[model samples]
Target: MGPVVSKFINELSKKPRIERFSKLISGLRNFNKTDQKEIIKELESVMKAMDKNELKGALTVGVFEEIKRMIEDRKLGSDNDYLLMKCIGYWKAMKNIVICNFGKSSLCKRFELMIFEEMNKKEGKNEKRLIGLYESYYLLSDDSIHENLAPIITSCLLKVASDKEESPETEKEVEMALLALSEGSRGILVKGAQHLQEITRIIFHHNDHRNLTQLAFQCAWRFMINNWNSNSNSQIVVVKYMNFLTVVKRELEELAKCVDWKREDEEKENSLAEPKATQIIVRWLDVLGYFFIMCNKWDDDFYELVRFIVELFRTARDNEQEISEMCAHALKMLAHNENSSVDAFEKCGVLDVISEELQQLKLENRLASDCLSIYLQIVRRLSNNSGDETDEEKRKELKRKMFEKLEEEGLEDVITSFHETLEYNQSYYDHSLSLNIFDYFVNV
Candidate 1:
């Protein structure tokens, strides 16, 4: 968008692609050292503006070699601009080039070594360089290069996290490191599963640092989502030995005891009662939902997890829309599994919460519609899934009780209103869940 980048893109768009771009690179280098430094500052911006074909053409003429040479000549921490520009330029070039060609290029391995060396520097003197390296790694999330570099990055992050002397610089380092890990490939997560213990520690130890704590939770969720279904061994390593969920459960328990969901003052000095507390709660809700649903096992821990979520719903004010939606999703995940029971929902007054929230929901908001769908599923499950009531009389009695509860909570009217609104605004059949639930209520 800048003038320099615009002019460069215009020049590169001319005929004879490689010759033009190569000549441009040559021209930039031909400038005197002082001018060249200024030109190099604009180089990354220009590269970023190129399309995939244009980038391929640039790489064909070995532009990365020029960047690499510049990086090699500059001191790591002294000349920060050159290193950051070249490192980021290399990353952008890697992204545009086809992945099949990535394996053949030695750039990934060479770049990994550079990052590894910078991350191991003593006393954190090269914190800026480490930040740059972490950012470059973060930018490579789309590429498979993370499969090779994730372990090394995680190791370095653990070392920095374990350092007792904390500062803004180290916290920023940890934040970026976790950001990179959060975007890591499934292979990166499964292979680096051993680091879950350290990551979990980072989550709780930095509870007051909202960004760090949130990123750490995101990394844990990424790991669980990647490995929950197919890698039981990895799950065992994280959940059983590392006690990842146990630690999270303990944190939630402590929060439940101290934090008031209906508190009028979010600006209170206590961090747990802060606005960011909602974000952390939302993330953990996602993690706990996916973990219990995918793991496909029953335990008292899940019951307790459901209890915490339900309590959140029961106490959360009507203005807390995000918490309400996530609670719906979390409860749906737990109830969708056969091993779990809906008794927790009934006892925790989630039915009352759902009924109240549904009446105020606007189906126009995608989240509200999705929440409505989840609430419908949970209601349907609790109504239909008779776990051990084999006797006909007992089954009918349970069904009657559920239906009576639904009626007492005015669910039929709320659902009918939802159906009418959707029919008027959008395709009636688009919300087949609402339509079907409406039909279910009518048939009963």
Candidate 2:
């Protein structure tokens, strides 16, 4: 469409094999007509104009060699960081070219081996070169690349994370490595299992610094979440590699203690500052819900984990509302597992605790709206084993008995609280949700 693209396409069609790409190679030399950005855009557009298959075949040594020469040439890279950044940007832009014409193919593998040879520790650490190479690989990374690339990249990340003597400047390198792992294909995540434990240990160490914790969880969660599957082989691998879940569970259990750490002070003082350490507690609970949803059945320790959550709901600060909302959601997921029974939690006084929390919401109204679904889910889940009564009148009586049981369990105002929410919701704001909420109660 543009003159540069039009001229490049015309010149490309006029040649064959390596020669067809001559205009593109020379386009990098800038004949005083355009800058690096325009040249990069022209290269991108030229690739788009040709047949993808033909383009794949035409992908030859000349194009890569030219780009490589341009980058390696000290005048462009070594002398100017800004220009080197642009060169890297140009490389990233060509990812579509790599993916379109060469991705997952032996060609990609071949290119990677070349990069690895150049970037090897024996060759010494060249952050610029490594960054460029990894950035390109990160862009082209997918399922096909993972089987080969994951182990290599994950190894690099482990090394970075484990190096206690690593400089502060190297944090980016560590982050880049983890990011590459996080973005890998599911097979890559599976492949990443061999190094996961060491990686987890390293991440836990770094998470103590807090600066790296978010990416730490992301890197850890990526492996755990991606490898999670129902297949027999995957299950074995997931279970073996998924001790990170136990780590996370313990950390979450401890953080749940902070939920009520300052409840008395928080209730009375707007001046009370929330601890930054506890900020991610709700997010941790939310992530745990995914784990509960995916696992086929409870592990032997899962009952204790459930008990922990129940006690947490009884104590955690509801001022933020997220803690309780996510806890309730995770409980709902546990209920969805037919093998999971509410009997154990019943003995823990969990129902009574949840009821009192709902009543607490009623007086405060700080989290009343958020707790509605939570309260309703608690009541419905507890009523799962209502009875074997068959007759309609008998069922009505049974349902009434269930309601009365809820009152005895400390949710005396549960129905009344839900009604208030239903009224408030339907009057002005919610329609579908309001109708659903009304049905959840009325149908019972």
Candidate number of the best lDDT? 1
**lDDT per residue, candidate 2, 1-444, as tens digits?**
457656755666556533544565555554332344454454544443443344555555445555555544422323232232234323332222233333534535544774666666775677656545654565444445635555665566556556645666766556555545554433254553457566556655655665464534555565445555556555445544455446566777656555555566445333323443344565456556666656654454566676777767655654544466667767655545443443534544544555566665553342454345444544455445545444334435545644666546545445555664565654543232333533344235
Scored against the true structure, residue 406 in model 2 reaches a CA lDDT of 59
For model 1, the stretches where C-alpha displacement exceeds 4 angstroms are 1-131, 139-146, 162-176, 183-188, 192-246, 253-274, 379-398, 421-444
- For residues 1-444, could you state the per-residue lDDT of candidate 1 as single tens digits? 445554654666554544654555555533444445544554454454444456555654245455455456552234443344444445342332333232234544556667777766676657656656654554443354545566666666566555535666666556545545544432245454457666666655665455454445555445445544336675565656556556666666655555455555443333322344554565566666666566654446656666667777766644455566667767656655654555645555555566676777776654445445555555565455455655434435545665886678776777766665554333532243545545335223
lDDT of 1 at 253: 60
- For model 2 the local lDDT of residue 268 reads 30
lDDT of 1 at 392: 35
Residue 326, candidate 2: alpha-carbon lDDT: 64
Choose the strongest candidate by TM-score: 1
Query: Distance (Å) between predicted and true CA of 299, model 1?
Result: 1.6
